[model samples]
Target: MNKCVGTTEAASLLGISSRRLRQLLEKGRVRGAYKTGKFWIIPLFNHLPQITKGTRGPKGKWRTSRPPALAKINVNRNHIGSNIKKSPKDRKPVISVKRKGTNLYGNEVEILGPCKIVYQPDNPLDCGARLWIDLRSRYANETFSDIHFIGGSFPATR
Candidate 1:
């Protein structure tokens, strides 16, 4: 039941900008903000900056989950996903499969395990679906690493 804004309205209400809210208020991380004279007095937080759990998107590897066996670090011959060029037995590293997609909270998902594939490529929108195995069942974790579909003949369980 409290509020307090300034410093560019608390960095535009936490959308973050005003010089990153003055570097999070000089690294004090706002909280109750202070510093008068030149103004800073910020303290409006209806929830915005906590975002933990692997720190999602922008290369933090999103929720992680992707590198279970990107071809076990490619033992030698390369090529997998997009940029097609298959060799090492038609390359395959990039696991986690459970089908029926839509995760990250959009719900309607149906993969009881694994799911991590990504090869985005859309010239105005290709449609082969370019890989993108998908995960997010809370970062699905059954100890992962199926060794590229275990002893071959895949079938971890439909």
Candidate 2:
């Protein structure tokens, strides 16, 4: 099992596409690698029978908890998910906002002409919710610099 093969040879030996082979190697699923200046080398462990596709590990895709937080970065301000404006003949401009739980990193923001409030949830509960506006242009030096509550209050927790 000490055969050293190129990426192409490794792909052919596994009867899989080169992309897939590379993925397996990167993920540590296969027992081979491309040394700094040598071909892909297969270790003795690789001689074992291949694991059939679709086999689940102990957790089986269901996570008991959420992922970790991202590296701290500057705040963003500009595209704030502010209230929508609506024009009326007998009434003032209507404003609508919402607050809800989200599945991704941050809350989901949606705004219509101006009617009702919209809410979205955040992924990691520890980081709490935040109002991020893309401040890449107007504030050339500042990447992010705005924070508002779902209820439009400072230090507001939803």
Residues 1-158, candidate 1: write the lDDT tens digits: 55566777455444557885676577675566778988777654442222222233353111112223222111111222331665655444333333223112111223334566455565211333443444422232322333223343332322
TM-score of each: 0.18, 0.26
TM-score of 1: 0.18
lDDT of candidates 1 onward, in order: 0.40, 0.34
> RMSDs, each prediction?
16.4, 17.3
Candidate 2 lands at a TM-score of: 0.26
- Worst lDDT run of 10 residues, candidate 1, spans 70-79
* Model 2 residue 18 distance off true place after TM-score fit, in angstroms: 0.4
Judge candidate 2 at residue 90 and give its lDDT. 24
- Alpha-carbon RMSD, candidate 1: 16.4
lDDT of 2 by residue, 107-143 (tens): 2232211122212355422334243322232221122
> How many clashes does the backbone of model 1 have?
3
